[model samples]
Target: MSFFTRKKQQNSSDASLVLASLGGDRDAFCIIVARYQSLLCSVAYSSVGDVKHSEDIAQETFVEAWKKLETLQDPEKLKSWLCGILRFKVSRYRRKAASQPIEGAEDITEGEDHEAGQIGLEESAIREQEQALLWQTLEQIPANYREPLVLFYREHHSVAHVASALDLSEEVVKQRLSRGRKLLEKAMVTFVEDTLAKSAPSLAFTTSVIAAINLASPPVQAATLGAGAAKAGSLLKWTGLVTLLAAFSGVISAFFGVRAGLAQSRTQRERRSVIVLTSLFFIFAIIFVAGMFGFKHLAAQHIVSPTLLAVISQLWVLGFVFSYLWLTMYLLQKTRNLRAQERIFNPDAFTHPADSPSAKQREFKSNASLFGVPLFHFRFGTPEKNDGPVVGWVAGGDRAYGLLFAWGGIAVAPISVGIVAVGGLSIGAVGIGVLGIGTVGIGFVGFGAAALGYKAYASMSAMGWESAFSGGFSIAKDAAIGSYAFAQQVNNEQAADIVQLALFGQGYLWLLGTIAALVIVPAAWHSREVRRRMKR
Candidate 1:
């Protein structure tokens, strides 16, 4: 059967069902309840103003209807009779409310003037900050007349229908809605005056939300972005930047053909590779350095948010330092090969330089000792005669005594320190030493990305002697926190702390990303190439 046809038949039989119920037919009484129960409940809600109470009223009205069925003069007016009973119940409820003593009535509007002033002060405090706050005004209607107002125009000024809906007299409904309109001017003026007294663009994050209900304008917005939009933008900017750094660094690592080389073993291609590698270093270095320096007109517009600045500031700076590390490693190879030409230097694995007129080589003889450590002293041999190693001194007296210490030098030895150095125990921009210290250190006691030390700190990844603080993948015996962290005692994170979650998630995500970039993909590619070569 069609739904509309069923509905039509039900409506047509309502009058017949009312008659049957009046004649004491139980099945007909059930039909009448089913036919009008929802309508009664809705009408009851408008009167009692409580959904649950209105439901109770509907049940009472139904019980009374069954009892008084014989008293209903027109069986067709059965729905109307039920509605009349609902009005009596609502009237009793309102009278009961009026007799009760109101409690804590003064607290709702206390200290209103103080809250008004706070809105402006908060905005001023957060102006220089990255917060972008905006306020919105709402329509003000009179409270005194709200109870009397019955959705008038929509109901077309029909007093009977309005009174029935509100369970009020037709006269009262007409009087209240009319008086409410008359006070509209006074209500609007008071609302506007209160708002004007308190409104200002100066709002803090908390006050901004409250002030947003009335008076709001954009805060001294950073990057022309609102709070939500800027957060999204900064998130994208950071993710893209870190990902690019990893990709470019991996590309440079691959292109340089990871191998150890001496001056004689170096081909012309290898020397040129130094130039190419240096250029690659500058490419990533410029991006990170620019962010630090605040290249406003460029892609480094990340300074708009201070929190992003602190996090990304570390990122780019580390990138710059890492680039220097690659350069240091490359130059260390070159320096070792060139230095061998000057003196008998021990190198287990060697990469000879390109074939130059170096069958005959001159060795600079100089050495110094510091802190019982020997230092090799020599000058850079010149761009034309760039064959001399970058090392300054060598401990040829006791070859066991190894130290490439100077103002700054790259040491291939176990212990070294230049202004920028690399060795087992070294200090420089990239500290690839056993116990090293630098801007972006990496070693047993290092302080940089993937840093491991007795006391180590890195933004992305850190493993310490006891406890480490990192963005992700951290391990410490005393305490640790990252995206994936393990610690023995005293963790600062709680189940509800969002900052901890973000840091931990970020660390693990980037670590997985870096591993994919440097190890997994390269290994897979190498494996595929090996298989292909064997097939050939």
Candidate 2:
């Protein structure tokens, strides 16, 4: 029968079984269990590598299936559905087991023997020697490929059915099956060669069994029948390697760049710069490491929640942009300050009334007026007149706030949603509660810091203005007005500087947060240790 027709018949049988079991027919349930018991056991065994545990997993599968029988959409796919549950159960068990103490010597050896026996078969010499040989060949392949092969051939499943059972794409199923066949064929050839060279006279019979089994086996030419099948394993391995290298490079570049930038900062700025840079560097490191470990693809495939990935990506982008903007603004301000200082020191080089001849003063004054400086304005008025400093300060403050919101939101939202999505509402609620508390704490801390900094700046500005006004000699009323205007301009410039400092400080924090969220958190603790040592 065609695969589809066979599947239809199986579905019909399964539907009857479900109906009977739901009607309180114990025998019908037992029949259904009996029909799939071995397959479920095998799947569990493959996943967990322990027969006893596999048995427990299989029982759980049946219990779950029985409890949820009403929800079964198609009877024919019942076996595949049960197997899927068993796989998940086994994976969970393995995860749990990994955290526990190791098994004792007796348990370990017994488990190994049980696994060997699970696949081992001793058939009657005359009845099915060839089939046994084929089974042996199947056993020799890796579990990754073997499970799909067994599902496709032994269970007589289609590619789509096998893919669903294994939670893989149909293309992946086909690829694995193809590679599995080649590996099996190579194994069979080796087996035949070994048997032929054996000193025992029964070697010829073994060869005959292998040849006969090859003939009886289903026609599935794994190597030649599928496109790109042979290279799939290689492709996956190389891609993983390349991704790991790229992630590592990005993390290193970010770390050193931040270090250099902070190292150049004034002593007063270093503490905040270091804290912010360290946080951001670690965040990106976490994300890069996670990507290296295939978490990116896992999230994409819906094996893990997608929110974590999105939040990390968005936070990193925002942090990087803010940092870049802050750096650019800082460089521009520094360059302008240097030029201003040079002009102040070399006053004769500047086109001021004291530097220029009386005849040229008219021309200079006209030019200054054209550039928005009033014709009678004093030289010091130029300092107070420039709006660039104020604008830069405002822009910096905006960027800082924008980054703070983006980073804080990214970290908070994913953690809240992911916990709930993965662990349900109660667990998720606790996560959200913690995050909400943290948000409040951060807000209070930021407000307090901003207030303290503003107070300090105001005190300094008051002192500086008083010093400038008291130290100056007397001048005419218009010039005095201009001097006060210059004082106001100086105050504005100082305010811009203060704002820039605040923004840069906050920008650094956001960058650090991004690194911590993206990179450091996800990196293996051992890898972090390695990185520290490498830096040293």
> What's each prediction's clash count?
34, 22
Give the per-residue lDDT of model 1 (tens digit) for 1-536. 12342243355444444432332233345545655554565455445443345555666666666665545555546667777886787777667656752522232123233434666646544431211111111113343244334234324446676566456788887777677666556535344333322321121322322222213221110121111111111222333344445345444433432321212233344456546654555565456534544522221132243333434544555566666766655655654455444333433222223222341122223445566433543321212234434343352110112444332334445654332445776543455677664435566655544456664455444556665544433456666533334455322222112112233333535643543343224323333332332221
Candidate 2, 1-536: lDDT as tens digits:
12342243244456444433432233345556656665676576556544355566777777766655545555556777787787788878877777663653456556556645666433223213443465466567789987776556534447886676667999999999889778867647555334312211132332332333223321111111122112111211222232333345345434543443333222333435445645654554354334423533443245654345433432432343344335434533543454355456655444544322232221112233323433321111111112222111101110111111111111222222111111111011011222121100111111100001111111000112121110111011111110011222121223223222223322434533443343333223213332332221
Stretches of candidate 1 off by over 4 Å are 1-275, 284-363, 367-376, 382-409, 412-415, 418-425, 470-477, 481-486, 490-536
lDDT of 1 at 78: 64
TM-score per candidate? 0.29, 0.25
Model 2 regions lying over 4 Å from their true place:
1-11, 50-52, 67-77, 104-106, 109-144, 152-175, 188-536
TM value for model 1: 0.29
